[model samples]
Target: MLAGKRVLLIIGGGIAAYKSLELIRLLQKAGASVVPVLTRAGSEFVTPLSVSALAGHKVYQDLFDLTDEAEMGHIQLSRAADLLVVAPATADLMAKMAGGRADDLASTLLLATDKRVLAAPAMNVRMWEHPATQRNLATVLADGVRVVGPNAGEMACGEFGPGRMAEPAEIVAAVEAALGAGPLAGRHVLVTSGPTHEPIDPVRYIANRSSGAQGTAIAAALRDLGARVTFVTGPAVVPPPAGVAVVRVETAAQMLAAVEAALPADAAVMAAAVADWRVANAGAQKMKKDGSGRAPALEFAENPDILATVSRGALRPRLVVGFAAETEAVVDHATAKRLRKGCDWIVANDVSPATGIMGGAENAVTVISERGAEVWPRMAKDAVARRLAQKIAEALQ
Candidate 1:
């Protein structure tokens, strides 16, 4: 989507400034011309040489460079690019932008830009959630600036929450959305991922070892294709991607409700590892031993079948995709599951512990549809997601 377009990327100060290098590469690889603008604080984490090397363009940093001003004035520079992006849009930078500060080259260009601006914020979780930052964010948003993510996850400060910068792929997707029309443009997709916890008590629960990497990848992939994605996710180890509406749930029941609420989607992908059963009589308080020399005998009740329910619902999505995790006869099981669940397609993978795919980074999956099954070679989860998302684009078309 970025082919032949020019992007004025302003790198901001933050640990995530390093990710801008990769973002530049992804942009260029997609045939976009990248113009580098590195801030003074941004240079603290990444060198000008490295930024210049990756972007294949000279780094512009000084606000008053005589040669630069003589050739391309700051205002002209802003007008030249098709889009302006700020990765690692730190709290300070964003605050300044909200206040229309043009104190330096980066801020000056941002102030001068007549084009749409996208910012991917990165900061400490507390700072990100702070009232001042929120006010500034609202200010920028009101200024017609678009925001990607300060996704939830582990941060550089050893704290875990919603402060991490969106991944390079995710930011690239947002950039594409800002710049041109994508394959899934104007489409809405709903994706469920991660493992649901069937609580036995406040302190313990039942859950599978699903890291939600595949689902996260899939959501990112769909977004990259320009789909408006509603991601209904569980407690995933990997954080949710940017540029999508996320609904967090803990139980299968909650997931079902969230999915149903996010209906009217063009497509739906059910990839969560939902527990089949939840405790029938979950105790309000933690269970205690009474020195009876016996463990508690708990009863179980079937949890809502999210995939089947959504597939069979009156508001069924146009394309319903489910997942089948099997230890044996993966394709056959998924094929049967597709029919049984009334889904249009099924993605099957072996999670037999031996495969190490349950919580692993890479995956080997078989995509089963009504036409037949297609065996996908073992590869990184992101690649598989890209392929599946492409298939979805074709199917929807």
Candidate 2:
């Protein structure tokens, strides 16, 4: 999506600055032109030569370099790129940005840019969580700047918390979400994900084993295509992708409500493994056992069919896609489901334990439609999502 685009990368000083090298590689791999800007403190971590070599563009460092100024003024340089990215955005750098400080070339360009900016923060755990840093973060976010991560993990200081920078791949995804051809641009997409829990009691519930990886990946892919995505997610194992509106729910009923509320969408992808039933009469408190040998019987009630409801609603989206996780006759079941649910497409997958697709990392799907089914070979869920999103773009267009 980023092919032939320009991204002005500002490398900030920190141990995490090293990851910026991989970030540059990934950005270039996506066909984005990289223009590097190294700060005074950033020079301590990575040599300008290294950054320049990887970016294939001269490092823009000095605020007063006569040669650079004569060729391209700072304001012109800021207006030249499609985006500005700050990897390993230190607490100090973030503070400066929050305060609107433009004392150096990096800060000046940040202040001067007319394009959107994405920051991947990297700091010590305490520094990241400190109230001051939190305040600065809120400030920057309020100013229309998007932040990727200060993911939780072991830092170079041997401290473990959310101060580590996001991986190069995750950062790349964030970039794609922010700046891409966005074929789905100006389109609103509603996506549901994960397994919905049907509460039986305060402590017990019925649920499925949906990891939500595929749905999360789909949302990211759609965002990369420039869709304004409303992600209606259930209690998910994986975190929701950044830069999308997330409405979290725990039950199928709640998921349905959220989906309905995000109506008039261009497309809807119902990927959640919503439970088919909930307890007819759930206990308000924990059910205690008396000294009886017999067990209590529980009555079942049908759950709200979120996919069918949205597909058949008065405000039905232009494209409605459902997922059929079947143990046998994948294509047949999915084809039937597509008809039964009144959805445009159904993604069929085998989850018979041996397939390892229930909560696993990869998937093999057959897309069932009115035209027929198309079998897709097993691949990572991310690849499947990209393919699905592209298909969605075509369908919507």
Residue pairs clashing in model 2 are 182-225
User: What is the number of backbone collisions in each predicted candidate, taken in the order shown?
Assistant: 0, 1
Stretches off by above 4 angstroms in model 2 are 1-6, 9-34, 37-58, 61-81, 85-181
Best prediction by lDDT? 1
Query: Estimated TM-score per prediction?
Result: 0.69, 0.69
* Candidate 1 local Cα displacement, residue 321, angstroms: 0.8
C-alpha lDDT (0 to 100) for residue 110 of candidate 2: 91
* Candidate 2 Cα RMSD (Å): 7.1
Q: What digit string (tens of lDDT, one per residue) describes model 1 on residues 1-397?
A: 6788999999999999999999999999888999999999999999999999999999899999999999888999999999899998999999999999999999999898899898999999999989999889878877878777766678888998778898898788778876646778999999999999998988889898899999998997787678999999999997777667989999999999999999989999999999999999888899999999998889999999999999999999999999999999888888988999999999999989888898886789998987898899887686688779989989999
Report the CA-based lDDT of candidate 1 relative to the real structure: 0.89
Which candidate has the top score in TM-score?
A: 1
lDDT of 2 by residue, 75-170 (tens): 999999999999989998999999999999999999999999989999999999899998898788778787776666688999876688878887
Candidate 1: worst 10 consecutive residues by lDDT? 173-182
- Model 1 steric clash total: 0
